[model samples]
Target chain A: MKPDAPVLQTSGLSIGYAGTALYEHLELKLFPGTLTCLLGLNGSGKSTLLRTLCRLQPALGGQIELLGKPLQRYSPQALAQTVGVVLTKKHYAGDLTAYDLVALGRHPHTGFFGSLRSSDRALIEQALEAVGMASASSHRLARLSDGERQKIMIAKAIAQQCPIIMLDEPTAFLDVISRIETLMLLRKLAREHQRAILLSTHDVEHAIRTVDTFWMLRRGCRPVCGTPEDLILGGAMASLFEKNGFTFDPLSEHRAIAEHARPVGIEGDPAIAVWVNNALIRTGRKPSPIAPSYPCINCMGKNRFTVGMPNGACKNVSSVSELLTLLHEAESMPAQPILPRYA
Target chain B: MRAGLYPILVVLMLLLFAACLVYGSVFIPFDAVIKILAGKAVERTAWQSIVLQSRLPQAATAVLAGSALAVSGLLLQTFFRNPLAGPSILGISDGANLGVAAVILLAGNPGQYFLGGYWAVIPAAFAGAGGVMALIIYFSAKVRNSVMLLIIGIMIGYLASSAISVLNYYATADRVHSYVMWGMGNFSSISLERLPLFAVCTVVGLAFSVMLIKPLNALLLGETYAANLGVNVRSVRMQILLCTGFLAAVTTAFCGPVSFIGLAVPHVARLLLGSSNHRQLLPVTLLAGACVALLCNLLMVVPGAGTVLPLNAVTPWVGAPIIIYVIASKKHIHYFNEA
Candidate 1:
């Protein structure tokens, strides 16, 4: 295979269960030294596509080429040597240590007895260190956090020495920090190792920042593939959630929920005003810059605030909660400032 | 630690084997037993027969049966990904029991069946166990879920056991008496003459298990991951079913559903080694099963009690507490929640 050729390429591929195609005639490519994120709504065939690509499930139609060879042609061992995958489903690895779990990635390379030779041991250690889990090599999976366990799983994939790696929802269960860390790790692995890495994830914001390519899957639509910026510029990300009655917002990297509310002007330090604006939006109110009127919140900074009422009365408050409460009372009282004044 | 534990387990198994041989219902002198085992002429001919024929075969049967059943249990537990899974859980042993019940109860005279010697039950037991295994393999392929396959196996076992109870109800009193005695399980049934056949079948089944260690370890990551690692998941599943079936069937055939050793020894092995990698787990389980079985055999003799307990009666005493501890211990919960 040419060095610049896609490590995993597909043309007119269809994937689904038992003759019914959830996706049909799809074109996809994963190039070396690039991280691709497969993004989709629930039941949009993300998992089915990954499973079919990994040969865990049979494709309904089309052809997949792994390293310039037809997927159906490679033996299971050869295929394993080329493609490494980390599934979303947790397995019975709790009793195994990080080293033991990662060593499992060397199955295709190991001999008949599956014993680790010195070279295999070195690779296992390198894989562990690559994932930054070298210190935790002796820790059993059960003792590790979910993110740590996921890192070990990636280390196992790395130890496989495969040119292409695919993960299904690798960050689905991790906290925000772990999600970012895992995505950063994937990008690092793709770049430093010059391997093609594809991961399916719901962490779109992080993926947008870290991944080089995006495959947007929508039901009843031809799968769209491009750079994350290209998809956003083309407005494909906005409509990706259209079928589910959601408008995807690229800026937020989530479904945009339109909130209708009365606008309240916030007069405060710009830094403090941003948080106050966020608090207002969360409470079904919009923050407006024009603040020279009643029904305005004065953010005096350091968590102290004053709410101006329509009745020309001002309520001093020490907290955002108190400010919002005074605003609530003024709004509920039909243009009358009914909030109790403190002496 | 596991490296040190392996030799200790081997030593323990050997000591238990010797103890089983030395302290049966009639205590045999250690020197006389050693001499007999060496094929030397002992002072009394009866001592020679007692050591070579009675105690030796019984001890050997315990070792073989223990290893076979324990490995079978390990395979089932790992295959199902359920720590609670064992030989008896799938009803393969009960199928063997049903087969034995059919041979003893349906045949006109139990004495005539015994005329072929203690080997008569082997064929029927194999058939019964093999039949259930075939059904399980078929369902395992059809049902995508392991727990569902496990439930179906249990239901099949219930059917076999219910059939046995019905057979017992219709049989004559003396025939039922003979069937019940067989149900109690005894290692002494495999005489010195028949030990070779039992040894061959058990060893072959265990060899198949040894070949499965790599795939078994791969499967610890579940079927999809194992497949990704180049394991032929379907073929491995079939191999596991066949190996566990052959081992469980052969041991149940000869030893009459020897309990607890199959279900509990793997857990003991895992706890001692602190790893489920199956590289060490399989062999350690084999040796530990032998040790436990031989120990149970020695426990049956009860030293100076002058009476031998039924094999099944002594097995639960050793097996049940280990299983209970495994279930109750928070440390091992990761092994259980897999299913």
Candidate 2:
């Protein structure tokens, strides 16, 4: 195989179960040293497509080439040496330490008994370090948190030493920090190790930030694949969630609900105004540049804010909490302004 | 820790084997038993005959039967991914029981059927068990869900049990009494003449189980992951069914449905080793099963009494508490490392 050849490629591929096609005639390629994210809603055939590529499920139609060889021609063991997978299903490791679990990834390379040699052990250790799970190597999987377990699973895949790695919803059950960390780790693994890494995730914001390529899957529509920028600029992201009452916002690279609250004007520093707008939107009040009749928040400076009410009563606040409190308190007052004697 | 535990378990098994030989309905001195085993002249001919004919075969049967059943149980549990799954859960034992029931109740003069010295019940049991296994294997292909396969197995067990009840209703009084005795189970039933056949079958089944350790370990992660790891999931599942079926069937044939050891010994091994890697777990389970069975056999031979207790009656006493403890302290037991 040429060094620059794609590690995984599918042409005119169809995927589904038992002759029922969820996707048809798909053309895709995963190159080495690149991270590709498959973005889709639930039941959008992302997992089905991944399963087909990994050969866990047979392709309903078309051809898949692994390292320029026909995928079907490779035996299961031979395929295993080339492609490693981290499934979404939680495993019953059963009192196995993180090290033991990761060592199992060397099974294809190890002999029939799966006895790990010194080199295999070194790979296991390196894999653990790659996922930042080296410290927890001795700990039983039961003792680890979900995120830690997920990282350990990824380490297992890394220890397999495959050029292509595929994961299904790897960050689904993780917290925000762990999710970002897992994605960042995959991105690094792809670039540094020059492995073709493909992961399916609902986290579009992170995918947009980290992935070199994107495969957008939508129900009843052919999957569209391109660079993240092309997809966003081509307005494909916006249409991706159009049927689900969600609009993809290019600026945030996140999907937003179509229904939004009425806007309230705010005059503030650009940085603070962004946060202020976020706070207002979270409270069901949209931030606008102008809403003269409604209460407008005027940012005096950092950490200082003044609410200018329609009735001419100006209230001083020091924090976002105080600002929200003043806003809520002002909501119950009469609409007519009570003119102050000094004013 | 597990490395240390293995030697301790092996020593314990040896000690129990010695106890099974020395302590029986007829108490033979330890030295005399050793002499008898060594093919030396013993003090008395009866003692020699008792040691060689009864206790020796009984001990050997206990070891093989116990190991076979335990390994069978382990295979089923891993295949189903349910800790509670056992050798009998898949209806193989019930199928054996149904076969025995047909012979003892439907066949006239059960004594005459056994008078030829070759037990027809053994072949009958093997056939019935094999039949159920074939049916299960057929269904296994049709039903991809493990839980559903488990339910189907349980329903098949129920069907076999109902058939056994019908046979019991028509059996003669004496035949029913003998059948009930057989159902209680006994390691002494395999005489010196039949021990060789029992040993060969059990050893082959166990060897097959040893070969399955890799795929069995993969199965711990569930079928999909196992497949991704290059395991031929369908072939492995079939192998497990075949091995478990043959082991459970042969053991049930020779020693009437030896209970508790099959269902409980794997848990004991898991607790002992604090791991479930089948490479270590399988050997430990086999040795532990032998130890537990020999212990039960020793307990059955009540001191100062000529009569021995039923094997099943004594088994639950040792087995039930372990199972109860396992169930009660499930959260504390790291049977599976789950997040």
Candidate 3:
């Protein structure tokens, strides 16, 4: 095996339960010092693929190689030392403190009795510190919040000292802040530890910012894999959620749009214009500076704005809240017949 | 908290054991019992005989059976990841009951047909329990879902109970009466002659449980996490099944299906320790189980006017309240948080 070979590789792989396949004849590779994000709609086989890669579930057909060897050839214990995993399900550790839970990662390295050596303890402490969970090391898992629990689980994987780590929807249950923190932590681990980290997430926007590579799985299609920029520019993400009126906007990093969004023109200072555009977009109105025959907004100051109707009737507002409320009411009103002069 | 509680549990267990030894129908004074235990000749010969032959074995049986049943409950609860799981819940004890029913009802005079002695019933119970355990293990392999496997166990238990009920309906009056007494459960059934075998089996089961501390702790994180940690989930599960089956079977065969100890004691240990790390929980559970069982044995003879309560009848009074506490405060209880 070449030293520069990807940390994980799969060729012509098929994944699913029983004889049925959710995906087939796939090729993928994850390299060291890179974070890869797998994005897909629910039930698109992201988890199944991860399970197959880790050898937790049998692949329907194909080859999975870890560290440049066939996955099946490594013993379960050997595979554990090669690849660590954080599953989507919540772990129940009974009354174990955060420290005790992380120490369990030493199972593959510890003695038969699972006694931790001094070196093992130091690694566990270091892993906890890496995830910023050192303060909660003695805290019971039950007492910690979902974000804290996730960090602790990551710390456990780190303590395992594997070359590759896989997580299934690690950010699924966390708040926005935690979601960003977790993705950022994964990116840091990949770069600093020189480990290959692969995670599946629904938080595609955040993932796009932190991941080195993106693997997109869409229903009934071959998985598309590339750098974040390649997938975005190549329109792979747009096709991912294309059925639900969702489009991936590269400039804004927004992956989905509402089906009934209306276009609104805005002219203002660039700084205030960005905020106004964000406000309009959030309210299901597409803000653009160049659209004619549509209602337009002109931001004259930080807290003042004018709404110009297609009929040339203008309403002035002093606050964003009032502006939004006026826009909402106007949009809800039925359109009046256009006069000959306005037309 | 667990470290402090260990010495307390040891003292409590010893006190309960002494209580069981001294307070029986023929009450010997505590000092006299101690003297008798030390192999000294007492003034009354009958007191020595009662203390030596009956109370000594009864107390020993309670300790062994209690610890064995508690350990079995802990293993099953962890394996199923269900707090309500126990030896009885999995139908192993019911299987033993069916075995005894078969021997006493289908065969003529349980003592006359096979081995011509009381010893025949034990092997029959072991076979029944072992057979049902094998069936459950087979189903477990086929059914990947733990909840589904648990439901299968409950259904298997119901089938065994139904079979036993049919046997009860057709058996002779005297045989039915004896069977009813056995079903009520008794710690005194194992005479001094049979205590050695009982001790051996219980000890072996408990020892095996100790060896599984690491895997049990791993499983506390769930099967996926355990497997990720290099635990062979299939083999560990099978080992747990075997240990639980053997312990529950041996205790049921000798003691006529002692109740609640197997179901309730592990929770009591967790409550006491405030943690479920099996290294501490298992030993504390063993001690707490012995204490609870010994206390129940003492309660059985509380009336003292030549009337004794059935072990099963007395067990629920102690076990039910603890279970209720667990349920009532389940949200506040850290141990039940995952469940």
My TM-score estimates for the predictions, one after another, are 0.91, 0.93, 0.94
What is candidate 2's lDDT per residue for A211-247, written digit by digit as tens? Answer: 9999999988888889999998998988888887656
TM-scores of chain A, one for each prediction: 0.84, 0.86, 0.93
Output the lDDT of residue A302, model 2: 73
Model 3, residue A290: what's the lDDT?
Answer: 55
- State the TM-score of candidate 1 restricted to chain B: 0.95
Q: Which stretches of candidate 1 lie over 4 Å from their true place?
A: A242-255, A259-274, A285-343, B115-119, B337-339
Say which prediction, candidate 1 or candidate 2, comes out ahead on DockQ: 2
- Which stretch of 10 consecutive residues in model 3 chain B shows the poorest summed lDDT? B108-117
DockQ class, candidate 1 = medium
The weakest ten consecutive residues by lDDT in model 1 chain B span B108-117
Question: Which ten contiguous residues of candidate 1 chain A have the minimum total lDDT?
Answer: A334-343
Model no. 2, DockQ: 0.66
DockQ of each: 0.58, 0.66, 0.54
- DockQ order, best first, reads 2, 1, 3
lDDT assessment of candidate 2: 0.85
Tell me the TM-score of model 1: 0.91
